[model samples]
Target: MTKPLIEITNINKSYQNGDQELRVLKDISLTIDEGEFVAIMGPSGSGKSTLMNIIGLLDKPTSGNYDLEGQEVDSLGDQELAKVRNQQIGFVFQQFFLLAKLNALQNVELPLIYAGVSPSKRRELSKQYLEKVELVERMHHLPSELSGGQKQRVAIARALVNSPAIILADEPTGALDTKTGAQIMDLLTDLNREGKTIIMVTHEPEIAAYATRQIVLRDGVITEDTRKGGEI
Candidate 1:
């Protein structure tokens, strides 16, 4: 069997608000194998988002372990963690988080720029991913010029431009209408079919059905985990 691309063993996270310590995660452990699409389902205030942040390496856990592709990462310093995040994980959000000032291609190139890649290489890579999302013709279009679905497509391309080991999507369809959301999910499913490991957070069961595995979180802990056989 293939080794897991992401591993969390007995993980926990907490935050302090005005001298009040609020625990958000509790002894959670999970593994995501490469190319396996999974959905994390939880109501508001559950630890799902916190887990996603940890998996994305955006926040350090208060305790336990995170191993990414066989390396212990929960203990890495901020700088090394940033490096891992830049080169290893891609993020998609419900907000479409694009810069209003830049065109589609420019937005997709931002990660490469942060990684200190050359300008010419950035352009080539960004354009290649734009093509993958069928947005080659709209590369120069700004976020305001694109429709909701188009913008999400551009976001997907941006997430893929880095070719990271995993994609972390937080409510990716929350901002779109039903039809557009379905289209976006189709695109994500296509990406997964092509062997990109995708872990997404969603509250909609219909949306979760697109994934091969489902995990439910409640009160800062995992409550249920399910796997669908045969096909995604």
Candidate 2:
């Protein structure tokens, strides 16, 4: 049998808060298969962001096991973890974290530059992904020159440029208006249909509805896990 793309078990995260321990995630365990579109939903302080960080390899759990593509990741060193993160996970943020100075194409090309791709190949891949996000025409535009949705599209293109195993989107629609948010969600839905594994963090029910599976977190614990067909 094929292994899951991501398998996490008994994960917990905590932080030190002025001599007190503040738990952010509580004994969470979940598996995500390739091509699944999952939404992690919660109110503020629900540990959804913490969970996303752990899944994206940006933060370590206080304790737990995480296996990406069947390999244990909890044991990797900082450099190893960075390498894995760079190669395996793509990130999209609510802030659309594009560099203000870089044009859309250059921003998308940044990952390949870090990955040490040839300059020509970086340009080729970046343009391809920008086209994929339907922002090729605006490739030379800076973040400030683009609309909110266009900026997010560039962010999406950057996320796709690495061809990572999973796309981790945190409040992707938070920075846009309703109509533009819907358009972004439609793009995400279309990407999922094309076999990308998307894990999105969202507080909005309308946004979560775009995903095939919804996992609700409350007070650092998973309160509900539901699939479109039924509860899972």
Which candidate achieves the best lDDT against the true structure? 2
TM per model? 0.96, 0.98
How well is each residue in 129-192 modelled by candidate 2, as lDDT tens digits?
9999899999999999999999999999998888999999999999999999999999999999
Question: Which clashing pairs does model 2 show?
Answer: none
lDDT for model 2, on a 0 to 1 scale?
A: 0.94
Query: Over 4 Å off in model 1, which ranges?
Result: 230-232
- Model 2 weakest lDDT span, ten residues long: 1-10
Q: Give stretches of model 2 more than 4 Å off.
A: none
- Residue-wise C-alpha lDDT for candidate 1, range 1-232, written one tens digit per residue: 8679988999989899998989999999998899999999999999899999989988889999989999999568889999888888989999999999999999999999999999999999999999998999999999999999999999999889889989999999999999999999999999999999999999999999999999999999998888896422
